[model samples]
Target: MSKMDKKRMKYAAKPGLMAALDIGSSKIACLIAQPFEDGTIEVVGVGHQVSKGMRSGNIVDMTALELGVSATIEAAEQLAKENVRDVVLCTAGGAPESKLIAFDVAIAGHEIGDGDLRRALDPTWLYARQNEDRRIIQTLPVGFSINGTPVRDPRRLYGEKLGVNMHVITQASSAVRNLESCAARCQLDIESHVVAPYAAGLATLVEDEKNLGCICIDMGGGTTSIAVFKEGEVIYTAVIPLGGNHVTNDIARGLSTPVSHAERMKTLYGGCFVTGSDSHETIKVPLIGEDDSEENQVPRATLADIIRSRIDEIFEMIAQNIKDSGVDPNIGRVVLTGGASQLAGVRRCAADILARQVRRGRPAALRGLPEAATGPSFSAAVGLLHYALAERQQTSFTSLYSKEMPSSRFGRIGQWLRDNI
Candidate 1:
């Protein structure tokens, strides 16, 4: 009978196909899934392509990005034997920002209810409204308290005051618009936007890790993203502009090799730490703009040194970010995932630099996912599917002001109050 109830019914009536699209600087990936009656989804299609016209997760060339999106989606559709018009997009660009906001509402000694919860969250909505130049990606209720005492659920509790702590994540509006435009050009509609690191965390983190507190670091091609989870919710997030591509660039410059060759070399022979065998092994690096005969022979130790310096720098930056966030340094563990995390010794390097238990994380195994796509690089893409499922089931709070809300600011606020209050 209520607006939210009607919306739920509408979605329930049409549990159609769902898709997740992850557009990164190095690659664009698409996954198509079919939901079942038992509240589970199975992957039916998977596709990915080398990305172009993207830098640090933002679109640089609309046309080129459009082509990549179209191609990736088409490939997935072909595999799925189904056409999809809407996709949950996973984004790491747009200068994502995260902050915790606390708010309280006077309950007048009455039993708390949904109305009280909404009223307590009014400050968060107001905060979102004030930032016209940014779009909210997620607004999560991290904790609740009644009369200044921490409580899990304040509903039905007798309290004069109800308080809530919310974790809000936002991104620049221009970046969101560009991504939307690119999707539109590819004849695709964005059903929702999930932050990359958050998505990765959802897919790769175990329930214990989330509830007990842990950090999920997604090192992608152009950027590295961090998400801190506590009590089964994200408490903080940060993005660093350095990633695997930076290491590749370093290798290319240090070895005087082409970017493509440098990447291949890194993938095949690079490591963050030198080994005793490194000095004895040799790798032939082809000189840029030169014949194969002019290739330079270098000790594997030299290549490892180049990679070690950059990877160390990346981990150091991550360490500094965690410290700057003011989060507990002893927080349970650190899970590292992404393309860069696949490098040999990356886990060890991360442990050494972050001084925490570090493990390479990959997306949880899906029914139809290929083994090749089960690596850390696909965590964000798979996590988008998890986000879609959570949103559909209403198990997670996607946002206070969702896409289905009224268009006008005043109208939206009024409708929200009327619905909840």
Candidate 2:
């Protein structure tokens, strides 16, 4: 092989460094980590800042967005003392769509082998690429069957017919292109883009919850996304363009205050559930363009009431969306993650509306994380690290096809010659 090819292979084989860039509506965060021999990821660097030039998780201004991304990555690089050119990105934009496609083929009453399996999974990208405006992001083989009997691995199994069920996720092309454009302007290459909620599910859901069934809600600043996992695979995805920002807007309108003051109020005194003491407790709201002496005071109960109403509507819409997709919200437990899910009383509110036990999900603890950074807000970034590790271990098509061949180079050359010549 040429020197360049050898260099590329060496880089690909190394598993020491991994980076995840989480771009959300409210904030942009970058994490750099290294996977050790003990199956642990040690964080080396982190960078986070207020997000700009984004709305509803989509890039609205390319120049401004590129600057934000550049700044975030530069900060992370400074801490790590190492520069990175590529990153694993997390996306909640593009109105992600998920569906299941089934493939079946005849095996001629023979034992299933790699050839048969390949045929059964043939044309994988072709089918998903039928739509010109959509691009496939994830393609997972959820189940396999031999002779109409479901089996996890059909290799060496006897069967007349083999079938496979694949769960595919697709997103709008325009959204993806915009992200790529911004990355290009920032001098970064995107290695992969995983859906925001799907990544959160990977970081938080336990084995039992994944096998049985579960719902993951990722609440962000500009969008609220939902992901459903059954039998340890993602089966459905949905996104709503309303999130914490909407609640802040509602508070501003209801209290006749500035957006900044409303946000502070929501973070400090917001709760979906009311208390008896709220009646006597009061909060001072600063009006737009007004001095401190002109601030208005109102009962805490009124603020809670406004916040609760908006939160209730969000959960109600989430429940209805699940119903519309033909999945019962009560089928499994609900896992809540992301920055907005950290609000007080949000879990209880979700439980009441979705009719399922709700638990707050946080990212797995890794070395070198500050107390302030280890929270649900970083779940997607953590999950991206996990995903990069798992994906690197998966078998490639070339290796699978050559599994039964002789190990020696000459023996492999003979086999290839016999097949081709």
Candidate 1 clashing pairs, residues 3+ apart or interchain: none
Displacement of the residue 383 alpha carbon in candidate 1, Å:
0.7
lDDT of each: 0.81, 0.76
Candidate 2 pairs with clashing backbones = none
Q: Give per-residue CA lDDT, model 1, range 1-421, as digits (tens).
A: 5432232222222247889999999999999899887889999889999999888877888888887888888778777877777889987899888877787878899888666665565444444354456666666788988889999778789988777787767677678778877877676778877789999999999999999999999999999999999988889998898899999999999999999999999998888877775778889999988988899999898898898888888889989988887888889899999999989998998889999998889999888887868989999999999888877776664343344532212212221111111
Top candidate when judged by TM-score against the true structure:
1
**lDDT, residue 10, model 1:** 29
- Scored against the true structure, residue 420 in model 1 reaches a CA lDDT of 16
Q: How many clashes show up per model?
A: 0, 0
Measured by lDDT, the strongest candidate is 1
